[model samples]
Target chain A: MSIPNDRKYLSTHEWHKAEGNVVTIGITQFAADELTDVTYVQLPRVGATLQAGGSFGEIESVKTASDLNCGVSGTVVAVNEALTNDPGLVNRDPFGQGWMIKVQVSDLNELNALLAPADYLKNAGH
Target chain B: MLKHTPFYDFHVSADARMVDYSGWEMPLMYRSVVDEHQQTRNSGSIFDVSHMGRLHFSGSDTRRFLNLVLTRPVDDMVVGQSRYALVCNESGGVLDDIIVSRDNKHYLMVCNAGNREKLIQYFTAFRREHDLDFDLADQTESTGMVALQGPKVIERLASVLPVDVKSIKRYHFETAKIMLIKLSVFRSGYTGEDGIEIILPAMMAGMAMKMLAGKMDKENATLKPAGLAARDTLRLEAGMPLYGHELDENIDPISAGLKWAVNLDSNFVGVQKLREIAAQGPKRVLVGLELEDRRIARQGTTLATSDGAPVGQVTSGTFSPTLQKSIAMAFVDADHSAIGTQLSADLKGSPSQARIVKLPFYKRSNP
Candidate 1:
């Protein structure tokens, strides 16, 4: 799978896409593939505050569980509720319908610290 | 360096995700764990279990030696019978759980891969101390083992195997020849399903795999290649214990709920301690737990009462693909081990409601 050029990635494998004042956060395809079958996802509730480089929730696969991290500080405006019933969506389409949370970006400068698509692809050993 | 099984090339070519297990490079899963698990329950699946230890015991005093070491009585075991037994330390702590099979000329024992060297040393020391006469040979690397497990396994095997596999009763085995290679087929498995585990020479494993694969339809495989991940889940759903998780040198068969495999009347190494434990009752007992939600309560999770009193800790847990629920096995205080007892599992910081249930959460109706 190709890394979407429109987003910036964290070294921990979380992708952040900034659109106007909101940034949508999700795990990269490489991370999902490594987790095998995604059985459950726990996302931060709407209106919850999140800080950059802080854990926002959790993601669980059949074999293990991992923390879901955030790259941009903001208030969570929306969450992917569909994941509650269909966690496999993350395995099938990790970039689109698998987006975990949408945050009202508190600062645009935080995005500069994340890695570019090419850099992420290189660091991820693609 | 990790050891490679004879089926290593096949697993790689099949795109299996290989991992290091008990110092062996084995496949964790080929496609997905849940998919392989469902394939086993619905139809059939083949597993490469060559990493487990296979030991051959022979000599004039083999029977007497086994009777003194094994928790189960070996005198009554007729030829071609297999029994689940445990080797225990002097304090009654489980050293390892093994399957002892009575063959025509000798006895075969299969044990966990991680404990293979430890068990061999233990047995060797015992033989030296007691001046027992027997020959023990490590055949794990010289032989290969595979399990064909599922509801459809017997019918599929009956057509290809030279013998009547269906007629072989549970816990019994037969020796047969396939492609001029001698093979031992046992009507037994770790999964809670009807299946057979076969042992053959290492050099013939590839030919046997190809021959078995020819029987299945490629488009919709009847016997798909499963991995260690599915095998663990399948055994967990069946309420079977895994070494290092449920059984250890610090844990005993009495507390692990394996009393049936222990014959106290026999003068085994741990018979005296086990008898005392049986008379006084085990302080902690293994029990099954069903969580209220899908979040897995993994190993080492703390178990507590509704009032926040710590009761026990989880030994193994997974989101069951068959029952579609989160199930776990834990060793709680004997007073809290009864079915229907409500306990809470501390998942990280939050607590999840859990209820004690029967040991086996899933049972095949036809069997």
Candidate 2:
């Protein structure tokens, strides 16, 4: 229900926590809340290359399925493997244990175009 | 005009995601569709089944009348008991699939909401043809139906709801009062869980929904309020046939893999044609198909052979929450309906490999 302000947010509802070149990415709390109960998460695989704004994964609810867009371009270094067994973790704690993948940012400058917590919250429709 | 259920405003107040379903403005989900689906599998979920119509048949010749009309024997179905039955035309085509429950001197039939009018006229015409003394009434407008499903529903409902559901057998019902509101509770649901479908009057509909909420809070229980979205996916994964997709004027119950429902020894209206069809199998058959890829094959998509020859078409398709795979039901050539029969589904001109599986794509622990 609460969005953490320390991470970088994307217009596509993904959040990033950058540490040096490696950055952790996950869907925002707002996104998970909007989607309600997540049934399946097709997370990006380790060592997969991704382009910014390109779809890297998918998530399916009961009636519909949606693509998970890549907010930051880079090789997927690490992925949260826990999601396959317990996708509900993403809904329970999107920012904490629900982080999808870790990617080495192709360009750190892309974060500059992303939104701040206040601005992201505004765009998320509260 | 599409009629709104009594709980229509309550759905809006709860912030249910709304969509137009068969011309009626109904909630697709309260929070999330998959979440609600899991709640029914793991815990409990409530549903607004008001859109399903209920028709009452009563009179002295209701027995003789039903025998001449429906494919099932109502005279054999004892009072306070329910039987899944089907009504077919004289030509052996399925008119609709319904549940006929014997209620006192009258017979209560619950049918698809979309075909209520047509079914009524068909039944009425049969009554006139047979010169039977029975009355048919549409109780759907005055009745409200809610499905409380899952393993935990019994524990949660026992606390606040004023009903002794312990005696209500599966597919059977009994009348009880809840918070001074009368209710006809049935121990049957589509979710394949141990639950009850409470039939309350329109004025008391909100009371039932509130009663479930009241019990959830009082017992510190968790129950999801599911909408039609989860209902569709859950039923599809359970391999249950929807009327329009699996049963229609073009299809018969025997071909749709529903032979137990059609009683041949009893001699119904469609008996002559059905007897012939039973001896010789129908043209097409319903089969389950599992796709390996995440790309789903939706309804009406053309089915094809491994070599890309058009064979049949998918009736319903969705991503299964339990199996973590895309599954669908399709009517195909009877010869190709066997298990592991490799085929391809033409998804918008692109073919996707699919394997034929058993009827139900997902089966729960219980039988």
Candidate 3:
């Protein structure tokens, strides 16, 4: 499992890649590996607002169901519709095409509090 | 510490995701759950199911003891026949569902691992009460079990075994030797497929798997290592009732749609209560639920009417890999258990459209 250095991670396991004021958000590869064979994903509406450290969605795997939390507060700019048709993408490419949502950043300062790759790996017990 | 099966090392070497199940550290998957599920349906797959309890009974009083203990009639069973039966409480509640196979010299009973100790205690008490002279042996720890399941299972088994795999009838078991290792092969499985479950000495399990791998490699047949996820989905598709999910102390065979296994004519432990249940139907009945869309209705989800009055509870639910739809088994009020009756599943507070479908959302083409 590759943990991209460019992306910041939350202790809850969600990852955020900042690009200017927009942030590409998804669950970390570590999270996907733990869940295994994701069968369903219920994402928030594209226009809905999110709260930092709040549950933004729900994911269901073969044997488990869990909440997906948001790392930072923002407006949901886009939601991955592909997951509805093929949820296995979350298992296959958690960091790439499996990206869950895109948030228009309301506070760029929030990224400073997120964990770096090294910190995340240690905290996640990788 | 969790118990480890003989295949524990093999699973770890293969990087399988392991989880604690019924006090056993068993592999949840080697590759991905969906991959294994599809492979088992289309090809062949091996499963390490050594956690299941195996008991051997022998002596002059074996048949009488079994007939009195189990809900099935065992008096007419031939040497090579096996019957699916339920061990019920005096009140007709299911203790465990078991498979009793009659060998030439003794009888073999396979019970669920989670209920092993409880069933053993129950049987021991019964034996003392009846003063029977039968010897009961626990073969679970001494033996290892692996199931080769799917459409292509017989061909894969034939590649390694000397006997004709197609000749053994379903529910029948035969002792065979492959590469000088004795295996008690049963032509049965929980999956809705033609498969065989092999039981051997624990020490020889790894060797047997290696031999199976070699045969499959030679034949170029489809065989993969499957896990508990696939096993569960496969059994659900087959409409087979799992013990904890569909059968329990609170649920009886009649309510769980296992009436065929309960022979009321025989005076068993639960005969009186079963007779009472037969005279007056159970208040709640098990029914199959098919979600109209892809949204999964998980277990413990409430089943409600279209207008939103709660009617029942979902026992087991999953995204049916075979049907490519969401399906579940729920215990609903008898009044709402009719086929095609419109219903809805309360999924995280949202009422998802569902309907009562026939039991077994998917059935094997051949079966």
Candidate 4:
């Protein structure tokens, strides 16, 4: 339920932090808690272009799976390889060690479309 | 609204993730599925399985009636003995897998909750048509079932139970009293672990669980509260067949790798068809599948040849918390169900390589 004040969240449960034109992407703690015991993470390949609100990959728990969506239009620059072997990191540290991908922003205008931390917390019923 | 068990409030207070299961509001997990699963495998854990149906059969002709309906021969079963068997339809298709326990004066049958109504209807119809002189009573609503499982489970149970838990042999039950409430404690469980399932009055369920849980907390013991999610994973690791997942009305026990439960010489509802299937062999058979990768192949996933030709479908699959690998049970073509046959599973449209292996992905060290 603790959403980092500096991050922006999507209604689909993903969060992003824009540092200049580069953004770090990860699912919020709310999402992590909802999808308990993540076993596998299908991440988007590096250098793949993704549109805002589009699904880039999927995350699987023991009993269910959910698609991971992009909060803003960007090009995937780097994916967290640590998650490939230890998907439970998402459950342990959804904000810190569990970042899924880093992207180079393709449209800064889309950033304004995301919800703030407070708004996201309210929207997620946290 | 779904039906709730006696321990529903206990589960909610423990922060269980509730899910709808066969019209029952059941806890999927208390902490996490993987954690609970590991805890159960390494230490001790308890599960609330009261949603399953419990039936009592009594009358002068109880033995004859059950012997004719159940696949296993229960005629010679002594008191306190339990046998795993399947209730088959007239065409050899399975109605439900059940455990029949013989008490001193009557018989008790435990079956899947989803198949309770069907089973009761079948029993009623059979009795009416055949003029069987036995009384069938549905004991599920008033009974509460809890299973304490794992290697160290006996220690935790012995702490609270008055009886010497070790005296009851496997697949046997003994009548005892917990807090003055009569209980039928069975030395059996689904996880293939050494444990006991206590069946008691529904109103006493909360107190009984609190006693067990309190004992664990007081002694700093290894006993933890697990849920259906962990139960599913544990049973999958143990290679046990679930009712809706592995066995269904269209699937016969012979094809589901449950031939041991079926007695060819015994006269049951589907004995003749079962005999024919046994002689000719089933066209498809259930086999254990070991995925080469960590990708979990879930139920309904299409299994096929390595070259992409479809062969069968996965019935039950999960990531085994013990093995740290994904495993599945699939009903593949009988000829292709060999121990070393290579196959592929269409996991979300991508084919994952897998191989058929001998059942039971994990076995207890002492077992």
Candidate 5:
């Protein structure tokens, strides 16, 4: 459940690990912890252009359904195919294996404005 | 902030995933909902239902008090038998749906968890207004409940309980001292299964659970601890309606498809309003609907006709585990509530294909 210092986090509980032009997006461990057991996931389509803060997908937990928002502006490169079969990976390891999507960043400058791990933990009220 | 129950500690120790459910911090599930739900369907499942309310009535004519307070008959109740009833306001609007069991000296009223406080206060004022010679006690806080539910539950629990589990008829209950504390064992539950709900004294609840758990382990029984998450799905598959969602302070029992529980024979506060509604028929009736796709219609989502005209609203909805498709219950116009009627459920932003199904989406294989 530890968030790496290298990644930038969104206030909406998503983490963005940027490596040059490609960025990996996933809901935070805190988000997955709050969601409990994930049942079904409606993932975003690959090769689709999604602006920052847009809904990339939706996830249903045992109790309720929640929206997965885009952490940074990008065009969808790839999505976690395993999530379609076993959505519970979101609960197992949200930071690594449960990454929702791979996006080609539309705005490289936008990543600089995102919250750091310390600020993310503060904003999340943890 | 979520309100914690008296059994919050017990839930946490059992590794329950806690969640804020309508202001109550309750166990979502101890394990998985699917497993727990199947355990209930296949074997037995225990539930921590300590948050539910128990209102006691002890007076010479407590039977008459029930006749006055509920829409069900008090005179017809057999000893040790439980009957479902609707506690109504003056306008035939349902205040709450409850189960009342007639004990020799008192009547035990089990109300919904969310409506416990409001119902107790309502009865207090009603008892005062009519001079109903009965005492009302909200024993929800001090009482912890554990339900052994499913087909094999009675047989499994029989090893620990002294009573002949097979002899206890459905909906009948009795009081006994299980281990050390006084206990009330009711052969009743929400799930469509042969089971019993064990009510133990608040202090000795842990003892009761430990004994049950020990028995389960010794027998190598397929028993799992269920929670509110599995409880909801089980109730839904069994065609049970949850209060606040399906029935509110405004909905009448007649419209909720609970006429069998309503006793129109004797007069109650809402008898006239009920009679008027019965005579004219209700505008909307609750019905179970099955969707073709896996997309669920959430609560408060609007129901529409094929032409997109709004008809009613979804009261409860979810992807049914057993059915393997989306299933929901909605209050539709009485004309449309008929079985096999086609209706469009507005799934999020669009209408989804659905049809009115039978009351119980899952038909049990009765012995």
Candidate 6:
């Protein structure tokens, strides 16, 4: 699967898609494939403050658990409610329906530190 | 360096996500752990278990040596019968749990992969100390093993296998020749399902797998290749004890809820210590825990009372695919092991409500 060229990513595998002042956050396809069957996803609550490079929540697959990190400092405007019932979406369609959070960016410049799609795919050794 | 099983090439060809497990490069999952887990429960799945150690023993003193070392009495076992037994240290702490099968001229012992080398050393030392006359052969690398498990396993195997698998009573094994290769098929498995585990020559594993698992890659195939990840979940849900998690040098079979497998009447290496433990009762007992929420209580998580008093620690945990709930196995203070006892699992810093429940969280309706 080709990396979506529109989004920026953290080296840890979280992706950031900025639309105006809001940025949609989710794990990359590579991370999802690595995680296998995602059983549960604990996302930061709406209105919670997130710090760039800080852990916001956790994602659990059958084998193990890993922390989910944020790419930009912002207030969480929304969380994916669908994940509460079906966490496997992250394994099936990680970029689209599996989006975890929508953050209203406090500083748009933080996105510059994130990796571009090509860089992420290269660094992740995809 | 990690070791590879005979099925390593098959796993790679099937696109398995391989991982290092106990110094062995084994497939952790083929596609999805949950899907593989469900396949075992509902239909059937094949597991490459060649990484486990297989030891063969033969001699006039084979049974006597085994009786001296194993917790279970081996004198009365008929040929082709298997018994689950545990090896314990002098203080009754578990060394490893094994399945000892009595064959016509030898005994077969299947043990955990990680404990293979340790057990070999232990057995050799014990044999010399006791001046026992028996032959112990390490056949782990020279032989291959696989478990075909699920509700539909017996029916499916009935068609391909030459022996009458359905007639082979549970816990019994039969020797058969398939395509000129000799093999032993035991009606046994760790997945808490109706299944059989086959042991054959390592060189013939690929051909045997193809013969047994016909067109497994097909979309509607009943027996697909599963991995270590799904096997862990299935065994956990079945309330079986794992070596590193539930059984270790510090944990005894009495405390791990395997008292039935222990024979105090017969004098074994740890019989005296085990007798004391059985009479006085174990200080800690294994129990099943059902968490109120989806958050998993991982191994080493502290267990406490509602008012915040530490009770025990989790040994293994997972979000059970069959039950759709967070379940864990924990060793709690014997006083707090009763069913319906309320407890809390300290998942890192967060507290999750937990309750003691009956073991074997899931049992097949037909079983």
Alpha-carbon lDDT, every model: 0.92, 0.81, 0.87, 0.89, 0.82, 0.93
Candidate 5 clashes: the total is: 0
Clashing pairs in 6: none
lDDT of each residue in B1-367, candidate 4, tens digit only: 8999999998888778899998999999888898788878888888999999999999998888898899988987989999999999889998999999999888999999999999999999899888989999999989899999998888767877888888889999899887688988899999978899999999999998878666543334578888999999999989899998889989999999999999999988999999999999999999999998778899899999967778889999888778878899999999789998999999888888989999988888886
Compute the lDDT for candidate 2. 0.81
Q: Tell me which residue pairs clash in candidate 1.
A: none
Q: Where does model 1 sit among the CAPRI classes? A: high
Model 6: per-residue Cα lDDT over B294-367, one tens digit each: 88888999999888999999999999999999999999999989999999999878899999999999888876
- Give the per-residue lDDT of model 3 (tens digit) for B41-98: 8888899999999999999998899988899979888887889999898899999999
What TM-score would you give candidate 3 relative to the actual structure? 0.96
Off by over 4 Å in 3: B215-221
The order by descending lDDT is 6, 1, 4, 3, 5, 2
DockQ of candidate 2 compared with the true complex: 0.32
Fnat per predicted structure, each in turn: 0.88, 0.50, 0.56, 0.69, 0.12, 0.69
What's the DockQ for every one of the candidates?
Answer: 0.84, 0.32, 0.64, 0.78, 0.29, 0.75
For B1-367, candidate 5 gives per-residue lDDT tens digits of 7766656787888888887775678888876777788888988888888777888889766788788878988787877888889989889888889999888877889988778878878877877887777777777768888888888888887887877777888889977776567888888898877788988778877777877755443334667678988899999998998998888889999999998888787788899989988889999999998987656788888888888888888999877777776789999988777788888887678577889988888866863
For residues B122-164, could you state the per-residue lDDT of candidate 1 as single tens digits? Answer: 8898889989889999999999999999999999888888989
Worst 10 residues of 1 chain B by lDDT: B211-220
Docking class of 5: acceptable
Cα lDDT tens digits for candidate 2, B1-367: 7678877987888788887766667888876667677888888888888888899988899888877778888776767898898888878888888888898878888898888889888878777877789889999879888889888887777776676776667888887786678888788888767888878889887766876655443233577678887888889988888988878887888888888888899888778888888888867788999986655778788888877777788988887877878788999988778899988887556577889999787677863
Give the residue spans of candidate 4 off by over 4 A.
B215-220
Please list all clashing residue pairs in model 5, or write none if there are none: none
Interface RMSD of each: 0.8, 3.3, 1.5, 0.9, 2.4, 1.0
Lowest summed lDDT over 10 consecutive residues: which window, candidate 3 chain B?
A: B212-221
Each prediction's TM-score versus the true structure: 0.97, 0.80, 0.96, 0.97, 0.88, 0.98
Candidate 1 deviant stretches above 4 angstroms = B215-219
